[model samples]
Target chain A: MEKLNKDVWVFVEQRDGKPADVSFELLSKGRKLAKNLNGNLKSVVIGHDVLALAEETFRFGAVEAIVVDHKELGHYRTMPYSRIINQLIEKEKPRVMLFGATIIGRDLAPRVASYTKSGLTADCTDLQVSDVQYLRKDYKDLLLQIRPAFGGNIIATIISPDVQTQMATVREGVMRMEPLEKHVKGKIRNIEYTPDPVDELVKLIEQHRQENKVNLKAAPIIVAGGYGMRTKANFELIRELADLLGGEVAGTRAAVDAGFINHDRQVGQTGVTVRPKLYIACAISGAIQHRAGMQEANKIIAINSDPEAPIFGVAHYGIVGDAIEIIPRFINVFKQKLR
Target chain B: MQRCVQTGALNQSIILRIKKAAMGFNSIVMVKQVPDTANISGQVMKEDGTVNRAKLPAIFNHEDRVAIELALQIKDKFGGKVTAITMGPPRASDILRECLYMGADEAYLISDRKFAGADTLATSYVLSEAIKKIGGYDFVFAGRQAIDGDTAQVGPQTAEKLHIPQITYSEEILGIKDGSVQIKRKIDGGFEVLESKLPLLVTVIKDAVSPRPFKARRVMAYKNARTLLELEKLTEGNSLLYIDQLKDDYVNKGLYIHTLTMDDLKLDESRCGVHGSPTKVHKVESVVLAGGSHEMIEPTKEGISRLIDQLLEDHILG
Candidate 1:
């Protein structure tokens, strides 16, 4: 396995002919890594009728797009997907591989690593290229995999030294997507997938994707609550503010544990990561777990009764008052101004 | 003294015997003693960004306790034994004792000076080796993620090392029938039910079920349970405490916590600790949020209007 011939590969995940946001983010980041190592950036697209998505990878920054289109690949089934990926790695021998830390990726990456006898760092928050010296050995141009460990208490930087390929899965909303370059052309290579017998072991009977009216990812404004809300009924303030702003309501793990909001609305380490343009935190003390998810918001406004609350530390604007009283008045002013 | 019975009665007894024999499910629960991250202070973070674990008090991982409770529940439903295992320093025996108080039949501590400073990959390698040595287990249960590492990778990695299937983020065990188990797992929005065969690894979440309180009787009985290291310390400089006699007594009373070392497991020294971990700390910065000229808006109607005006001026609102 010669490292000189290998290129950087990003797994472009798509559903219903639309690429996931993280796929584009990976391509943007992969472009930098490939350039730093002086290698070609390739996008691997696998699904049914995803030719448009294969071509779309070029705009994000892929120098070449590899498509493995198959009818059985429409819905993500673990066995078939892992087998195909493992075979590709065995053949092309990529120097670096990236996947989104999504449900499908999380399930598939470990299996592929096991098949290829490689090391993988999961749910990474950051990736960089660096020269590493360990145990009296020099590893140049190594991909640094950075992630929060110990429940967000510390960060760990991982590298794969001995393996032919280095793999990592980046969490959503961590990396900013690079602006698309128009009129950029890239090579497209299509491959036919032949399924092995083991792929038939598991069958996808049905998939139920709940209709989410509050799209946190696409929401530009988010009014989030925390444990200070006290009760489920008190969440009405968050809902009212979000409704007024035409945004979505989110909560921390504490609020979810208290049943103030559904798990889907959780904005923290173990939940959905959101990077809204404006984040209004109502009586929410910012724990590191919650901050890791939303620290990238363009602007933050924290309102709390305690002036010393941690949320105020990260907020661009701090309001030291009770949310119960302030939110109502703020809503009235906004309504009048809009009128 | 054989008594003749009807054909239907004979068939019923045979079915019962077969069911009893086949349904016996033994479980091994992997637990860890982690530094309480919630109560971290300034000194908890070392200069190298690694945790100064000695500065923080250690506690049994909360989710691991739930894993033990689930294992015990499975044992209660089907007649089998439950063993708790952990890989840490000798003092980790404290968690093993807590596992006993929570109804574990036995406990083992995989401890050695060489096993220190292990990342998720090395830790899972050692744990998988210990599991393989322990042998006959229908299921291996673990927490979804340890609070300390919070990687949520060890359980799946250990399963991969052992060449077994894994179900993670498990919330409930529906049942076990015909050598297959049904599990309810938490997904993004809702939960899904999955069915897998025996010899599977399941990582449980905090929302699975509330762990049961320690039994008072069991606590009183296992309070003095000690590993070999602690026993050696007890006999050190104290002529009254003889090591062999104390060990025999503890073993007879079922209070001895089994301890294993690298030599016992025959593990490769190269793949045991920091040497095996590929992760290196390139840099760590302590993030201290400094409020940059934050304004304290008064809790008044005029103040609310001023805040709205400022937001609009800043283009935060329309």
Candidate 2:
């Protein structure tokens, strides 16, 4: 039997021609999984003038880069873009493909998986090799991927019973990005496919371009606010704290509800998932929904009034206080040290 | 930022004010009330380690209702209607009633035992099938993820099942133009704004739209909205019950559920239930860790050395 493409491939998600940080993060994890499985890490790029991006992918830890450049592919449309990925999967048949569980990953992964009839685990908080392979005598491409369950309080490891090319769409920060210091040896493999000729399943009715995320997921430090901040003006406190530490400020669903932060910055089950070196939860009660989004951070520092707030359950260190009072002092301490 | 996305024709009265006042848009919302997820613990799970759902309290999933709220906001501004739909056990009617109370003009519950244990794929099939039956919808909105399963599949999967485009992790519906909706997608680092046409589906984040309070008047009016089964319980005597009498009574009162079963959809039996599902639970292993007594390792090298030496003695060291 012919072995399907046994290489590891990753999707380099970009916005308005700018690449997302999770792409590098995915590559970092990809390097490990590939090496573990005796495969290679290949990153796929689909955008215009992405030759520079191809070079950058290597810096981000992509061992090999695949570029599919087209003017129609310049803007994101579900149909044309999904077709591009489906074609790529068919030609390359990478054994394991990773995508950032960002907006695009949320949309495109299912479409691609359904198109290819493969299994996909979405918004996975944990990823690792499964141990069941030791029981199998013949199977060679078995993978044991792990993820958080029970809304992130427990870890559940899973595997595809019998599917080729086991796929997982990972949360942005769930994996860490390797530093771009020593350039790793890699190659750029070019495969061309027509962007047109596919039946248009949907039409682009109108477009209002917005700025894209640069490093929100891979940010070294993150300052996240919750309903504790109360009003929209209060969220500025979180932003100021983040600015002092050269970090990005995120919000919980409640903070967004209070009109403190926009929906994009939300960090919870339904919001963007991130794993940073340090996660500071301010006044966040740590609802299972919110915690499911970011419990995977390497170190968690929770600041809340309720000593028993669920956020403390996952925090490496905790402070029982008000967001209004504690955040200002914390910022002062941060400024004194880092400034 | 909380723009409603919709597809399909609506009563022009809904759009007239939007065209005139330049406010509100058409929207469709998906809602589900799941057992409160926070209520599980040791033996709160059963002896078998399965969830004791009967003891679990239910709440309108905070996110899915917010998706409905966003849709309702679109209806408020763009001058349209909000239709709320839920698929779950028959008891899910509890949330459909809440949807009705929350200002959705019409509501539906698609309940069938055959739909049980549906992974995201099977659930999407049934939702898409129901959508086809309901007909005439612009945009479909679902919570970014469901609390019970948290697969985040049904929304995007349903869109795929319908062969419509979907934008997930939608933080905000920025605007709608030429029947297409533009949205700010919450990506890993920042936001990506993508535009796709009407009839698109979007899975909304929890705060995408804060839901409005249930209206007093609508709550009172639809309070008696009964399903066919409930109606049967009420009129057990009529027509013995008279089939005609029961039908007329249900029609007049508008208390009908338009109940659908596996047979009505012409579904294959092999693909409907446990047999239809491909995923199997080989075994569920629950590990309970007991917090043990603390053993202190002293600061001094000798004490620490003794601690490590003891660790090896106790077989605690690899």
Candidate 3:
């Protein structure tokens, strides 16, 4: 049997030249996974003129940077991107590869996985390396992909024990993005792009990507609502409270589904995870999936009519009352106290 | 790249048909009957961590239903046949009928016990083989992800197995012209328009289009549509009916939802199910959240005032 390469690789997804924040997060996570496997952490940066982006990976704890530069790869075209990554993986045989579960990552990962004939899991919230025994066979140092399945009711630990290269597309913000205290001068191995005619089959007609209007991940305070807000009118109270506190307004997936909030403003497992300084949960019966995203906040205040609501579990302060009424009182109290 | 090598010969025919705007495209849609995860209740997760699917009502996956709507809309605009296929137990024919009601011309059920415990890899293998066996398809459509597993890999994986290009998270069909189809797909913050040649796959998101309501006439016509296994069950309970005769009648009348087993697709036994899967479930844990001590606040004015004062002192707020 060919020995499995222990190197951990993070696909440093980039748009234009700037790299995605999730790529840095994966580098931070890949650092830990590399340490566990006693291997080097490498960043696979692909784009036109993304050498600086490749260098940036070292600041995020990568030991080496593999750069693939080409004009056709300036933007993320699925065909070219997947082919480049597939070629690298096939040659390197890295033990574990990670990609952010962003739109581009989701599109490219599976195609690459299938083309390489490797195992891939999607939207994983947590990843770890451990030995596993499956079907009366023992496997060493497998990537345990932990994710909430069946609408976040249960968590399943999935492992690709039989495959040489295990891959996963992790949800953004689930892993913390931490730069090293001192940036390491990592080795850069530049690779050539061998263009194929198939890359031209799908033509990029037009692209319109605006900066996200809601920067919930960077907000210091978040006021989030849930389905219990009753109507879209009542849900506006959450926005009022967030405004009074100079914070961002967010909501649960159910609230988003109910049309009280937009999907972009959603904060949960299926949505973006947030670690605001304070999270004010209004009428949210915190499902485990919801908490997986926001429970890490420094201080949490939950307001719900039901005292037994699960949101109170992680709340520093819990108020058992109707949010429609109590939120108005909260707004009034803040106004009077600030005055 | 091997798939791309054949694109040269394929492109010649595709280009030759560019002028025929009225000619419709042949489309195949992949659909699934998933457990209603949105309304989960009452011991749905067994002690062993496997889902007690019996407790949850099975329904057509919303995104997949949307994919069917898109496919039907394509067929309506361009003239073509729409076929829907699913791989599940015999009971999964329920969703296939729903597909027929929603305007699919034909439906197929690929079911067998040997396919049990299949992960995404094995599942995609079976589906790809089924699609190939059906053949003559210009487009393959699937939902972005299913509600049950939330793994969106099957569509793209199947596309890869079929050796075709795939455009995922599609929101709208921009246009189909000059031997290529244009699509508007969702990205992180906005959208992108991409154009790909015919004989590709598209995975749709929920916001793509609202699934059309089942037509009254179509429902009346296809409500009794049954797969072979269903017909066998009916005949087993009745002494008067002959299985072969009933099947022939159903097929003749176009009421027989086509059925395929592993043997029918000629799939490698090892690759049809769990044995061919590379990934395995190491552990399943029902989420149990432990609540620690917390301070309860009064709903009165004084309570609200004190909470504000505490926030000011803690510097969490000014």
Candidate 4:
């Protein structure tokens, strides 16, 4: 039997030039997984002239970088991107691979997984390297993919024990991003992109990208609402409070689905993970999926009518009352104090 | 690949067809009936680490209905046929009928006990097989991900099995000109306009387009459409209505939802179901948010004022 490689590889997703925050977050998490498996942490950077970004991975504890720089690979085209990653995965045979569950990552990872015939899981919240016994078969050094399933009602630990290569797409903000204090010199392996005729099946004609106006991550305070806001009209109280307090307004997935907020303002496992200095959750039940994104805030205050709302578990201060009624009073108090 | 220079804006139905290599498009939309994950109860999961779907009510995945809407739009624009298919239990036929009500020209149910317990990979293999059996399709469509699994793997995986290019996260179909289809797809903080050759697969996002409401007339037409398995169940222990005769009658009226099984698709037994799934659920833990110490505040104005004061004292607010 061929020996399984223990190297942990993170697909460094980038657009234009700057790499995604989730890619760096995965690199930081991959560092620990690689250490547990007794191997090196490698970053696969693919984009036009993205060679410079390879060094950035080292700051996040990557020991090696595999750069596939090509003009065709500048923006993420599914065929070419997946083709390049599949070739590298087939050649390197890394034990574990991680992708940030961004649009580009979700688009590229599954195709590569199909081409490589490896087991791939999506939107994983946590990943760990552990030994596992499955179906009466002992497996050593497997990647345990932990994720919230069934709308975050349950947490399932999934493992690809039989497959040599285990891949997972992790949502952003689920993992802590910690750069190493000590920098290690990393090796750069540049792989040539051999374009194929099939790669031209899809051609990018035009692209329209606007700078995201909502910077929830950088905000010091976030006032988020949930389904309990009742109606789109009632959801305005959350926005009004946020406006009065000079903070950003966010929402749970339900609120987004209910059209109370934009997808960009959504906060949860499937949306952006934010660590504001203060998080004020209003009318949000605080499901584990939603908590996975905001529980890391410096201070949490939950306002819910349900006394047993799960959001209270993580809140520093729990207010069991109607947000619609309490928010106006809270606003009046703040207005008087600030005045 | 077909390429033709655009002639100044002319009637698309007449002039565009004259320049195009292919006259019409045939699309297959994949639909799924998933458990309502939002209304989950404590009994949602069984003891074996799998979801007790029987305990939960099933509904057509919202995004999938959006996919069907996109396909139906293509059919209306380009003079094509839309076929909706699902791989699930017999009860999944409900969604297929719903597909017909939404303007699908035909519907298929790919169900078998042998296909049970399949993960994304195994499920995609079976779907790919069924797609091949229903060949001559220019486009394959599905939702980005089903709410129940939220894996979003089956669309791309099935596309790979069909050996075609895919455009996931599609927002709208720009146009199909000179035998190539233009699509506007969503990316991080932006959108891209891409053109792909025929026989492509696209997975749609919820924001793509509002699914058309089921037409009342179409609903009246297809409300009684039943699959062969459904007919078998209806005729079970009823001597008068022979299953075969009833199926033929339904097929003649075009009210029979085509049903395919493992034997019909000739799928490899090993790769059809749970055996083909490489990923296994090792453990399922009910979400128990770790209890932490917290202060309960009164809902009165005085209590709110006191909380505000504490925030200022802690420098969380000023």
Candidate 5:
């Protein structure tokens, strides 16, 4: 029955001194939640010499920033990161914490939740705070966490009614970052913490950064393929069309399974969710799994041999044909016109 | 704590033999049966955003199958047993039988009418209790998330309830050495390799490995595996067949899937199902993006030219 602090906190995820855009997005959303709750919006940044990044959180909407600076925290080792974040939560007792649903966030949030014995909702698409009656008792200021379930067929809202601190990890690109307010200023609090020796059980060996890869989430235009591409070599057609259209190339899960493309390029419920302005599907059967990721695209065009392909169900434009034959002609015309 | 013994300068196979003799890692895979969302129809979605699961056909969750496959692979290499357990209605026994066909050493179905309407929190509590009851496991495996709930919280929450370390989005088991395991996990841009000690939980992603198809002979052998509830339905009102006798017969044949109720596990009724879950659905809206106003073009050269022209006009191409 301990009283928890009344503040909204956002975990600022950064790597190599660059703050992720999702951090800003969370700040924008967290600011609104803090305003509703009549509390201060705070940001927590953990890294080596990350004070500047903590200061940057204010431009996004944070009223105050907490910086935990340590060399061991630089590279996102789970144990140290979770240990520090959990310690901070235990000491500060923030009512609600928001994290970006990135890889590091997914790993760190659950571990911290476990350490603190709190509730966490992951990959949330939307979040809000409201009062509600549960078990015939009124609970005020509960975090309403909403996310697509059943493979995006349904959206479910979840809340932790009893837990002192409610936590959620929102997926990237699902929320828009607020425009920077250069005039806004925030105070920064620097804290020093040492990592436990056990936290070093998992040692960092080497990090190989992926180069020359298309990030489907940020792409405004995406040209994706499916099993209809026929072979791994035929994926070149998808790449060619993408290149001509100045878009990124993506694929269905089947295409990734067949080794037509790397798993990174796979788009679906299990892969990256994208909201491009233009999503062009070639020979994609458009299973619900695939559609869940791209249905949010502004404009969709489907070209396939089967007019009955599910991809056309959500398409803004439909062309029934063989992609092998149709793509070459389309690519040639676009190349000529753009050139 | 069990300290790993290092046999330096010993013969390699002998070292492996000693390790295997000293540590036989048993695994428990948490499985679920989810409604197939790929082929959802109008009837499958109720007016509330919640799914009318009764109207939809349920199948074994895709990632859970992969988790079982990973468990089986670990058992194949490390010399241990794989036990699959699911908490759902009696019909969830279908997936347990499928697990048997895929080479699980034992299958368990945790069912009770009181367990209905459980959210991830309640669901994980029950699953954690079941795992504790079926003790002596060094590893617990589960899919990254069930397609139906898609919360991806149960596995990690269960790990927390059990006070065990967990690895999520695991892609591969690099190796097992010195009472620890090295796992390659998928991340946003790439993958990271991390090592954790024994008695850890791992949530496997669908991209981890392609699950092997059910063996034909094993499928035939386990196709009739039934839970206790299923057995009761069969023996009810039959003068000649008694429930206990029929259960013994199936048990003797190695075709009886073990069943557990809330009382069997001594779980608190308040924390077993809907009563324990804190999440409340505020509203449900069926999201149907408008379509059908698209231009349908022919597959000819002129058609291709027109499509390109339209794309340029719309500025989607430029």
Candidate 6:
């Protein structure tokens, strides 16, 4: 397939009819990339009926949208999505394909790339266009894929050689979502795909949402407990602070392992990356892994008995008081403020 | 903070295989031979200032293979397949063949010049793609952290990229039933039992399971699976027919040397490589230690008085 098309493609991720939040985020990023490349941003929406959201996607900046609407593609199985995306690349041959580095994107991106025999940059933190490659003649692309390297210490630059259409899977909230403006013009091309069951070796088992739905990323204000919380009962301090502020409770790796909070509520390299508005950390030593997840919050308030706890380094405000004693005070102040 | 550890002693946590079982559950262990970050030599970086990756001796991350072994033990309990996925330089293929010898069905090397210096975000992006390409899986497991970087970010971030609910820092898989996965995660001091749905990504900490020793025969049989570059080297000197036959034979034999480049993922050239990265190394400096003097104190008041006087003389205290 020739890479002649001069438009940008964002995988419009949808499940059960609604678009994933990351889709809007990617569309926001893709619009900028398309503008820089002097091209149009497009959407590859797949599902039973998602053409309706095509205009909404374009309103978010897509110039053209590609819809691979089909019933077999209703539930996202690896094989069908891969087949459809793979077929779209061959037929349309867009200059770029960016996906929300979500579960489906992670599952779908590589299979499509492998089928096309191209390189894929996963979980991209930044995106841009550049003239870079290891080999001059064969491996050169005009677009640049930016990502974090060395475990978020250094930013590594990756350039695809010769593949006109490059693929990258980006994580949620790495880039801010821009609001949709006026209605944008676009066309939706529907493609047909049928993958054999023998081709799909893995069956779709049922997916269950955790009973204690603690989504760390989406939570507004987070009260994070650390090992300093000591016993399980002490964790109530974290919950009380969160409840008083109309927020959610999170934990440092220490508190979570101490059996205080669910693993989903963990904030760090092994946990969730949350950029809440307020992060109140109690007795949590600032390990790099723990810091990675919650450091992005708009404001951080550290409450540790030890004045020198590492959490103080990045906190917007620091309090050298026992979380046990201080949490009650904080709850009182929060209650008064709310009233 | 370093925890005092006895290296070879097995934690009492690992549960070995029970009676007769169908060949065990299929398990794929992910391992990375990262640079030993602890040993920073006196010599500063080179002229261009890249912290010499060559001088850094690689160590199999202590936590990652434990994740792999946990999976292997799970496969031992339930009958199934374990396939390992690694995205790195050609030398990383060394670890993939090692995964095979340890007990993986087949391993794929997702190597490309394009992926040379990717960060965790990009690295997980590439691996997620490879996992997606690999197709079938009820579970995707990774080590808690790579020691060299000490950034345990990859595993959970990869799970997020895959858009699956992840159970990280697992010390053991206590139970795996119809739809839920119950596992023991290493919290700060103890452990927590977490139950999440199927198709979840788990990052295993050290002691998640006892790592099975490398099996000698499987290692010998599968050691010849050349990475893309290695295969290219062999084909360079061979008879046209022999090279063609060898390449086709490896593919048919299922020795996955799946190679993809820029054209594969259809990534925008602008968003990948170094240029796409907005973060830059503002600076790196040596951290100094300043508390290394000797102090003598006796039980008596006179001795204590002398110590206090010395501290006062040094302006350490009033």
True contacts kept of each: 0.34, 0.15, 0.79, 0.82, 0.48, 0.01
TM-score per model (chain B): 0.89, 0.80, 0.91, 0.89, 0.85, 0.78
Error of 2 at A158 (Å): 3.2
Q: Please say which candidate is ahead in DockQ: 3 or 6.
A: 3
Provide the TM-score of the second chain in candidate 3. Answer: 0.91
Error of 1 at A63 (Å): 4.1
Off by over 4 Å in 6: A1-4, A130-144, A195-200, A205-212, A215-218, A226-236, A252-260, A267-275, A283-297, A303-314, A320-339, B1-31, B35-318
Per-residue lDDT value at A61 in model 4: 87
- Considering just the first chain, candidate 6 attains a TM-score of 0.79
User: Residue B295 of candidate 1: its Cα lDDT?
Assistant: 71
> For model 2, what is the error of residue B13's alpha carbon versus the real structure, in angstroms, after optimal superposition?
22
* DockQ, Cα level, model 1: 0.31
| Local lDDT at B203 for model 5 | 96
DockQ for the candidate 6 complex?
0.04
Q: Which structure among the candidates has the greatest DockQ?
A: 4
The runs of at least 3 residues in candidate 1 whose Cα sits more than 4 Å from the true structure, single-residue gaps closed, are: A14-19, A45-59, A63-80, A90-92, A114-119, A132-138, A149-157, A160-163, A182-207, A305-310, A332-339, B1-23, B42-50, B240-245, B293-296
Worst 10 residues of 6 chain A by lDDT: A203-212
Worst 10 residues of 4 chain B by lDDT: B1-10
Which residue pairs in model 5 clash with each other?
Answer: B49-B284
Q: What's each prediction's TM-score?
A: 0.87, 0.73, 0.95, 0.95, 0.84, 0.58
- lDDT string, candidate 6, B1-318, tens digits: 133343222332222223223334444455687876544443423444346677666666767777777777777778678877776677777777777778877777766677765655566666776677666677888887676654455675566566665655567777776556777665322445666666778788665567788899877777777655677787776667466677788888767555555457565545444443322232332221121222222323344345335433644322
The TM-score of candidate 5 is: 0.84
Candidate 1 lDDT at B223 equals 98
* Per-residue error (Å), model 5, residue A275: 5.8
Per residue, candidate 5 scores C-alpha lDDT tens digits across A86-167 of 8898988888999988777877776677667576777777788888776588988888887666656666677788777889
Better of 2 and 6 by TM-score: 2
lDDT per residue for candidate 4 within B150-251, as digits (tens), equals 888899999988999999999999898776999999989889999999889999999899999999999998999999988999998999999889999998
Error of 1 at B31 (Å): 1.5
**Of the candidates numbered 2 and 6, which has the greater lDDT value?**
2
Model 2 bad stretches (over 4 Å): A1-5, A58-64, A90-92, A131-141, A179-187, A195-339, B1-29, B38-51, B66-83, B103-106, B149-151, B167-198, B205-212, B228-239, B242-248, B269-318
Q: Write the per-residue lDDT of candidate 6 for residues A1-339, one digit (tens) a residue.
A: 744666788988876677777788888888888887777898888888777977678778887777777676666655567666777788767888888766566556655665554556666656887544343343323566655444333345666655557777776666667857676776776666565653343334334332335566787678889988899998887887777667788887667767888766777754567888777788886654566577777767677777656677777666666778777765664454345
